[model samples]
Target: MNRNQHIWLSVFFSLALGLLLWKLKLPNLFIYSLPMYPTAILPDFIEPALDPNHRKFFHSKRMFKFLVICLVILLLLASFKSQHYFFWFFGVLGYLLHLIAESLTFKGLPN
Candidate 1:
């Protein structure tokens, strides 16, 4: 898909995931409210970084993989701590969803 297509798809998927979470009545969903809204629109800002000539590493698949790993670690840590597992699971799921959305674009795949 093109950059614009990726952006719209990401927004749609993110919103759909958010609504699903909301309907599930998950606790601490409010904490994600701000991030979730911006997530739907983040592709606009992110597309520039995906430019092939850009030197920045933010648009790399390695970075997304690292982020996913980090989130999973956080989820694991949250599980061992006094925090709720559902919250951590949802957070990780959301992050993964974001990555998946990005993966639909050309820049999202690994080179």
Candidate 2:
């Protein structure tokens, strides 16, 4: 799918998640879901222009792991410094949506 498709799909997914998690602490996944629409295309620009494995780098498991680490680090740092939970949670959800959107293209993290 293209950028527009990814954006619409991510928006839909985020809507569902937001409703499902409405009672939870982070109910506003939709607020931060915008990041996924653009970030989902990062791999295409960063990877070789004509490379077949274009989505490998940004959508791969390593990238997901790195995002997890970043999230953890952010949470840990939040203990010491003031952090806006809304954006942080939105960013985390957006990152996951980026991965999920890629998977929809049948590019489920490099083998």
Candidate 3:
């Protein structure tokens, strides 16, 4: 997807996530979820849309898995009550959403 599409999707998903966070009584709701937008477009920034096959290292399935692992690790660390938990969590979450959005395309994601 294009940058605009990624941004809109991030906005929608971020708002949804924000609502969930609010319902769960999480603190600093906006600060946590707002990172989603930039992160959602981060892959494109790292691997620009220079060609039809621009998705590579930063946009691969392996990268998604890496993010998932990082998310899990962050959650574990967050359990210790780290103040930066939501920021990093939502950042990775946003990037994962970008890969997911790309995976829906005809090209799909690389290994």
Q: Show pairs that collide, candidate 2.
A: none
Evaluation by TM-score, superior candidate among 1 and 2: 2
> Please, what are the lDDT tens digits per residue for candidate 2 over residues 1-111?
555666676677767777765757654445554454555455555663364466666668888788878777766765566545545655665666666666666546774
TM-score of each: 0.54, 0.59, 0.90
Instruction: Show the colliding residue pairs in model 1.
Output: none
lDDT of 3: 0.87
Question: Candidate 3 lDDT, tens digit per residue, 1-111?
Answer: 788998899899988877887888874766877778889999999999888799898999999899999989877776787857877888888999999999999989999
Comparing 2 with 3 on lDDT, the higher-scoring candidate is 3
lDDT of 1 by residue, 46-70 (tens): 6554455542344457766776777
RMSD of every prediction: 4.4, 3.8, 1.4
Two-way lDDT contest, 1 vs 2, winner: 2
Candidate 3: segments with Cα more than 4 A from true spot: none
Question: lDDT of each prediction vs. the true structure?
Answer: 0.55, 0.62, 0.87
C-alpha positional error of residue 79 in candidate 3 after TM-score superposition, expressed in Å: 1.9
lDDT, ranked from best to worst: 3, 2, 1
Best of the candidates, TM-score: 3
Q: How many backbone clashes does candidate 2 have?
A: 0
Ranking by TM-score: 3, 2, 1
